[model samples]
Each structure stands twice: as C-alpha cells, then as structure tokens.
Target: MTIAEGCILVACLLPIACAWIAKSKGFGKPRRDGGFDNHSPRQWLASLQGWQARANAAQLNSFETLPIFIAGVLVAEHQQASQPLLDALAMAFVAARAGYIGAYLADWANTRSILWTLGLACCIAMFFIG
Candidate 1:
C-alpha cells in the first residue's frame, strides 16, 4: 500500500484508540467495582464522565469524520492526484485527528474544534489535488 493508504489505516484506528482511552481506567477490575462491563458496554460507556466522556465523544466524532476522509483519499487516488500531495494531506489529516483527540482528552474545547476543522480541511483539500 501507498503512504496515503497507510494513513487511511491510521485514521481508521484513531477512534479505537479514543475508545480505549474512554475505557482505560476501567480495565482489569471487576464490573461491580466500576470496571469496563463488557456485558452492557453501551450502558457502561454512557455512564462515563469527565475526560472519559470526552474521549467517548471524540471517538464518535472520529467515526463520523472517517467516511469523508476515506472518500477523499479514494477519490483523489482514482483521479490520479499527485501522490506526494495526497500523502501529505492524508498525513496532515491523521495528525490533526491526533491533536483533536488530545485536545478533547485535555478538555481544550477551542483547540479541539480547530483541530477538527483542520482535519476536515485536509480531507477536502485531497479532492482537489492532482
């Protein structure tokens, strides 16, 4: 796979990382003692608060943004866009997404939004590159 394609894989895994963050504190403990309850995962996740809650929210947003990013990369590749430019944009999108997750986990609302926008712009820019 190309560098851009590798970036797509990285982008796809971001949400999983966020989800892991959301559940990190609850790992390796009993469910009754506030551990990650696999039986009722949604309920357990719903009960999260603070940074964990934000992580969950970030995970959802990551998932929501993934389709567009994937589409942009695929469409750009199909159109024979400049490989280096496409790769750069894809990498930028991944970096922005990582920053967005960090900002979310840190409760930096404005920074998170800015990073989110940057990621989106990267995706949009991909469609125009050739």
Candidate 2:
C-alpha cells in the first residue's frame, strides 16, 4: 500500500485504540447508581466525549495529516514529489498526533489547540495544493 493509504489506516485505528483503552479502563461501563449506564452506546459515546478535550486534539491531528498524505500521493503519481519530503511529513504528522494526544490528555488546551491547527493547516494546504 502507498504511504497515504498507510497513514489513513493509522488515522482510522487510532480512535479505535483509544476507545478500547477507555473501555478496558471502565470508562463506558454502567454506574452502580442506576442513574448512569455504562454499557449503553450513548454511554460509550459520552465516555469518548468526556475525553474529548484530548480526543479532539488527537482526532484533529489524525485528520490534519490526511491532506498532506493525499498531496504526497498525488505528486508522487505525477513524478514531482520527493519521497524524502513525504516521509518526513508523514513522520511529523505521526509525531504531532502523538504529542497532541498527550497534550490533550493532560488538558493542555492552548498548546494542544495550536498543534492541532498546525496539523489541520497541513491537510488544508494539501487539499488546495494537490
């Protein structure tokens, strides 16, 4: 598969991984008070959202990388793209995503948002440039 495809795969898997981790940690299970149910789909979604401050950043980072990946593929297909550049951007995207997740989990709102924007710009740039 192409690097772009691989990056997309990673983007899809990251959220699943986070959800599974949350479930394993008892984030989605029903509460004993009978007022809150954990096993419900809503509960799971809510749990995910509860982690949103962090999860949102991670999601942004993942999606932000998509455009650059797409752009790289398009350029490569046209024989005008540098493999090294694509590799570097891909690596940066992944690293930024990891940092985004960490910052989000830590509730570092400002920094996380800044990083998220950077990644988003990458994707937006690719969409127009490609």
Candidate 3:
C-alpha cells in the first residue's frame, strides 16, 4: 500500500483516540456502568460536556470526513494518479485532520474551520490528480 493508504487506515482509528482523550484525559474517570454507559454512541456523545464534549464532537466530525476522503483516494487510484502526489495529498489531509482535532478540543473555532478547509481541499485535489 502507498503511504497514503497507510495513513487512511490510521485515520480510521482517530475517533477512538478522540474518545480516549475525552473519557480519560478530559474526565480522568471511566464512565458509569462502563463503555459509554451502554448508550447509543451518538446519544452518549451528545451527553458529554466541556473538553470531553469537544473531543466527542471532534470524533464525530472525524467520521464525517472519511467517506469523501476514501472516495477521493479510490477514484485517484482508479484513474492512475501519481503515487507520490496521492501520498502527499493524503498525508496533508491527515495532518489537517489532526490539527482540526486539536483545534476542536482546544475550542479554536477559527483554526478548526481553517483546518477543515485544508483537509477538504486535499480530498478535492485528489480527484483532479489523475
């Protein structure tokens, strides 16, 4: 797999990391009854408050980007785009996403939006890279 592909795999797990940040780093305590209190994941997430809430929100947003990113990568691959270009764009997307996660957790609204744009641009750019 290309480095881009590897990063894509890593991106899949980012939400898990976000959850960890919220539940452990932010709360410093496990949830009652364990494992998000057996609530529907989204419902449980909606119940979060403070930095944990932000982290949960970011985690949701992280999942939101996946379909577009995956489609872009697959389309680029089908069109025989340059591997190095795909790699670069994919990595940029991942980097932007990481920044977005940080910005969301830190309540950096402007920064998070900027990073979202950057990541979206990377996904869009992939389509034209053929």
Candidate 4:
C-alpha cells in the first residue's frame, strides 16, 4: 500500500486514541465509582469534563472529518494525482490532526481551530490534486 493509504489507517485510529484519553481517568475502577462504564460508554464519555471532555469532543470531530479525508485521498489516487504529493498531503493532514488533538487537550481553542482548518484544507486540496 502507498503511504497515503497508510495515512488513512492512521487517521481512522486517531479517534480511538482521543477516546482513550477521554476515558483514561476512569479506567481500572468500578463503574459505580465513576469509572468508565463500558456498558454505557457514550454516557460515560458524555460525562467528561475539562481536558477529558475536550478530548472526547476532538474524537467526535476526528470521526466527522475522516470521511472527507478518505474520499479526498481515494479520489486523488483514482485521478492519477502525483503520488508523492498525495502522500505529502496525507501526511500533513495527519500532522494537523495531531496538532488539533494536542491543542484541544491543552485547551488552546484557537490553535485547535486553525489546525482543524489546515487538516480540512489538506483534504480539499487532495481532491483536486490530479
């Protein structure tokens, strides 16, 4: 597989990492004691606060952005866009996403938004890469 395709896999997994960050504090404890309730995971996540809450929010945003990124890469590949350029954009998208997640966790709202926009731009650019 190409590096761009590999980036798609990494992009897909990022939300899981964010989810882990959101629920980490609740791990290894009983559900009744405010631990992560796998039985009602959504509810548990919804109850998060501060950086954890932001992490969950970022997870949702990551999931939301994934489809476009996937489509962008696939469409670019099918259109015979430059392989190296496609790979570079894909990598940039991932980097921007990582920055977004970090900014979210750190409560840097403006930085997070900027990174999010950069990621989206990368995806949009890929769509016309051919």
lDDT of 3 by residue, 1-130 (tens): 8888898897898888988786664243356644464446567667778888998888889999999999999999999999999999999999999999999989999999999999999999999999
Whole-model lDDT for model 3 versus the true structure? 0.87
Weakest 10 consecutive residues, lDDT, candidate 4? 43-52
Ranking by lDDT: 4, 1, 3, 2
RMSD to true structure for each model, in Å: 0.7, 4.3, 2.6, 0.6
Q: Higher TM-score: candidate 2 or 3?
A: 3
Q: Roughly what TM-score does model 4 have, to 2 decimal places?
A: 0.98
Listed in order, each prediction's TM-score against the native is 0.98, 0.62, 0.87, 0.98
lDDT tens readout by residue for model 2, 5-57:
47656755665654444344444445653333444745544544456434544
Q: Whose lDDT is higher: candidate 1's or candidate 2's?
A: 1
Off by over 4 Å in 1: none
Global CA lDDT computed for model 2? 0.56
Per-residue CA lDDT of model 1 for 58-116, tens digit only, reads: 99999999999999999999999999999999999999999999999999999999999
- The per-residue C-alpha lDDT of model 4 at residue 118 equals 97
At residue 48, candidate 4 shows an lDDT of: 88
Judged by lDDT, which candidate is best?
4
Model 3 weakest 10-residue run by lDDT: 25-34
Clashes of 2: 2
